[model samples]
Target: MNFTHPSIRAQIVSILTAWGMPKHLTDITAEIMVETDLMGVDSHGISMLMAYEEMLKLGQLRIAGEPRVVRDFAATALVDGADGLGHPAAAMGMRVAIEKARQFGIGAVGVVNSHHFGAAGYYARMASSAGLIGLVTSSTRGILMVPTRAAEPVLGTNPIAFAAPAGPGHKPVVLDMATTTVAGNKVKVYHLNDKTLPEGWVQDEGGRPVTDSRVAMDYVFKKKEGGITPVGGPEHLGGHKGYGLALMAHILGGTMVGASFSPIRNRTQKPDDPNNIGHFMMAIDPRAYRDMEEYTTDLDAVIDVLHGAAPADPAKPVLLPGEPEEMMREKRLAHGIPMPQSLIDHVRAIAGRAGVAYELKET
Candidate 1:
């Protein structure tokens, strides 16, 4: 199925409104979700709506509360999400970071008591749009990563995102990645689409890699015995680097914000326990280091050399960090966003349940 981006965003906003989220928050969240899909990130886009809504139903996400700043300083602050959706909290945090950087040249915000904030790059892009460098990371209550050689799971996917401006006449450079072979939620996406699992993505209880997506998904999300491997593959494949990055994300995103580590959270525990996820967002003004013209020219030159470099295959050109997504956005906007029939069905089911009209038109 295919649908225009605007149509998808509107439907999402309507359903979220029906679900009791404020219009302002839902509007922001809807744009982020649509932008994620526009970038061809099926694993993190509208495919996630039902799961987030479930968080609200289960009381893990506050349905009626708004995010509020709990503490403030010169260029750093703490934002209490009031146990609400992470989108609004994270967006607010980035906005504040941008504001602070305008004054102090650097700013950081920690958002606590929040739920999933879709697409970390969105917040980073916010800073880039303001002509500043940005960095963002988040903690998760769910755990699915296996250490270098350990069979047990201890860390969450824990993404890291950074973005920098190229000044005028060029796009920003943004990089966002999970510190695992794949994000934990992505296993669910593959499972829903009945796709085959890529090798080196998941591991069994004894640290043996699992190649069956369904089986691997169950092991990681339900059984909780087996898990996904860290960013690199096993220890031989530089998995330790991924393990180290995940822990660093936990420290910056969770520990610094007073959220518990995955091991202590015990996400599977009874209700009334919140995921208590946290996030860190930072903005740095490049003008503080050098003149905008000097910085922009250097950055553009570097980008040109990289793009001009030879590629292994002529059909595939060397791309910058955000080039692929930017290309995808252009293509998707010209045509329409594509989705598996199963995903279309899933989203429609959610809309039906929420009593909101499904505005997508199937091809």
Candidate 2:
């Protein structure tokens, strides 16, 4: 079913409020979720409602908590999220970074003890919108992936994002991606759709390839046996590159924030046990290099050339990292966001329990 952004945001806010979230935090959470849907990242959008509801029920998230600054330097700061929703904490961090970047040539912020912060690109885009280059990375809970030549799970599906301004009438060059072949959320989406996974995406507990999404999710989430693989599948295929990147993110994010690493932290069972998931963000002023306008113009020219590059496959032309997502965002914004039938039903159930009215737009 399709739902207007405002409607979806309102529904989410109402549901969260009913679930005992503070009014202000509920608004922030709803806004972030709705924005994810608006950006066509359905996996991180309203589909996460059930997960948030479960977290709230378990008291893993405190509705009224605010983030606190633990340490500060001229161009850097560390924030303790205080177990608050990741969106608000991240937003505040980016804002602080932007302010510092304006004064200095660059600014960096590290955050810890926050919940899942929707899409990393959103935070990067925030920096780009402020006329600065933005970079972000985060370490997630123990939904580890199968390492090369390894049978069991080890590392989390860490993600990295970068965003920079382009030119007039052009979207920023925003790249956000998981280090793994496929994110756990994508596997969760497939499971929700009653579909199987591809062979390359996961492995069994014994290190054998598996195509069953249920088994994959079960192994990673329940048994802690197997996990999703890195981008290159195995070590022979340069999977070590992805592993290296994941480790880099873990160090910059987790270690810097004083959080436990994936192998040591157990967040699946104890969601509120201060898993200390960490995030890092940096913003750089474009004027530091050259004239801002000329820099963006050159960036646009390069992107245009790449977009027009000769295609290896006629059916699948070259694409910029953010182009596909930008197209999806535009299309969804015009037609309203689509939700799975089961998700719609779940939302309705929540609304019913909360005494809030529910509406689904016609297809």
Candidate 3:
């Protein structure tokens, strides 16, 4: 079923507010999540509410919590999420970083005690929209990644994102990706669609590839056994690079912010304990290096050249990092966003539990 973005956003806001989430926070969360859906990232959009609902019921996500700035410097700062939803905290972090960058040419902000924030690119785009460069990273709650040459999983997907202003006549250059071969939530997307997993996205206890989506989802989310691989398939395919990148994200988002590492936290905390996830947001002002006009003009030239390049398939044009998402947003805005019946049903169940009216009408 296809639903309009406004309908999805309204349902999200209603359910979140009904669940006792602050209206302000729900507004921010709804905007980010619906934008994610518009950008065609099905795994991070409304689909994530299922996990959030479970977290809330288990006492892991606090609806009344608010973000507080804990530490501050001229160009750097830290925020405590107060064991709350990550959206508000992350949005604040990016906004703070953007302000600091405007003043100091660069800014770095970190958030601790946060729960799952949706697409990292949303925060990055906040900076880019302000005519600055942005970078974002976050430590994930689930231990879903099997590091290179590891027998069992040790790391989470640990996503990273970067965005830079593309100036006029071009979209921002944005790149958002999980360090793992595929994000763990993508398994849920496949399960919802009743689709099989592509090889190398997951592996079995014996380290062999698993393509059965149901089995893969069970291992990654439920059983928590042999799981997803690093960005590259394995050691032979340069997966070690991805493993190292995940740690880099962990270092900045988790270790730097003093957030709990899920592997270690699982051993020490109860199942319902707060995930204590962390986020890293940074922004750089191009004006610090050169005039905005010069920077943007050069960037536009580079993008133009890239777009002008010959395509391997003539039917498909050469596209930049964020063009596909922009295209998707345009398409979804014109038509309605597609929602699987299963996802719609699940969300309706959550709304029922929250005592909110189900308002996701088919478009």
Q: Report the Cα lDDT for residue 324, model 2.
A: 81
Ranked by TM-score from best down, the candidates are 3, 1, 2
Pairs that clash in candidate 3: none
**In candidate 3, what are the lDDT values of residues 32-117, reduced to their tens digit?**
99999999999999999999988988988887799989999999999999999899999999999999999999999999999999
Candidate topping TM-score? 3
Give the Cα error of residue 235 in candidate 2, in Å.
Answer: 3.2
Q: What tens digits encode model 1's per-residue C-alpha lDDT throughout 39-118?
A: 97778888888787788778777765699999999999999888877888999999999999999999999999888888
Q: Give the TM-score of each candidate.
A: 0.96, 0.93, 0.98
Candidate 2 C-alpha error for residue 299, in Å:
1.3
Candidate 1 runs further than 4 Å off:
267-269
Best by lDDT: 3
Candidate 2 is scored at a TM of 0.93
Model 1: clashing residue pairs? none
lDDT of 1: 0.86
